[model samples]
Target: FADPSQAYDEQEASQEEERDGQYFEPVVPLPDLVDVSTGEENEQVLFSHRAKLYRYDKDLSQWKERGIGDLKILQHYETKSSNCAQTIGSLPI
Candidate 1:
């Protein structure tokens, strides 16, 4: 009887070679994108720190974690107003 495992191995090797020989082109060529402004371009970062944020939950009666992010304090050049910016990773708790 033909070995089933050997057949599978040969099939896998053929598939790998087929994949290596294949050349795929994108259906639609993507154009280069211009940089988008975040409205803080005129501001300068005064301080930046990585912090974990938490919020008090009334129903759960405990502090739930908000997220871990880089907290930045920025000062505008003209207005000299300080603005806080946070970049968080993970889902909201």
Candidate 2:
């Protein structure tokens, strides 16, 4: 007879594996970037693998870069839910 407890463990393990692999699309690492100001909404992350520059003034956001240099990032987006403490712990301090 199959052990019920063992089967439960196996099922849990599979679920974990599936969840981990669900985010298959890799995000390009831009460790040097950061969001300088505090806002109710988090900064956005663009898919393009290039740095962007902009000027901000009380929600007056404008792109200053058109393939210009000094594309260092001032903010990076956090995709995971804010309620999930584990996800935030993984982010850079």
Candidate 3:
């Protein structure tokens, strides 16, 4: 038997050609880390370099920022990498 992913690859290719070059773009949004941990008054902040725990708030529909007083700077980096084995590919799974 051939490699298992070969058939899967062929199927994907066929689908791609049939669509006349339109492709599915992954809709990965920036994780909006919302933290009012430094209290509700301070809108501007410099985050600690070591802070890592994140809290998600369902009611407010955002993440509550922690380690506010400890952070030195806020840097936003948007990076993408896929671990196919762990990916929930073609969702509606």
What TM-score, to 2 decimals, does candidate 3 have? 0.24
Q: How far in Å is the alpha carbon of 79 misplaced in model 1?
A: 0.6
Off by over 4 Å in 2: 24-93
Note the Cα lDDT for every prediction shown: 0.87, 0.46, 0.46
Candidate 2 lDDT: 0.46
lDDT of 1 by residue, 5-87 (tens): 99999999999998997889999999999898777789999999998888999998999998899888999999999988788
lDDT of 2 at 68: 29
**Highest lDDT scorer:** 1
Off by over 4 Å in 3: 21-93
As a whole number from 0 to 100, the lDDT of residue 43 in candidate 2 is: 48
Winner of 1 and 2 under lDDT: 1
Tens digits of lDDT, candidate 2, 38-79: 342564433223333344555655545323232213333665
Pairs that clash in candidate 3: 34-63, 35-64, 35-65, 47-71, 47-72, 48-70, 48-71
TM-scores of the models, in the order given: 0.58, 0.25, 0.24
lDDT of 3 by residue, 1-93 (tens): 888799999999998889996768779977788764522132322343433345799999998753222223332233222111111222211
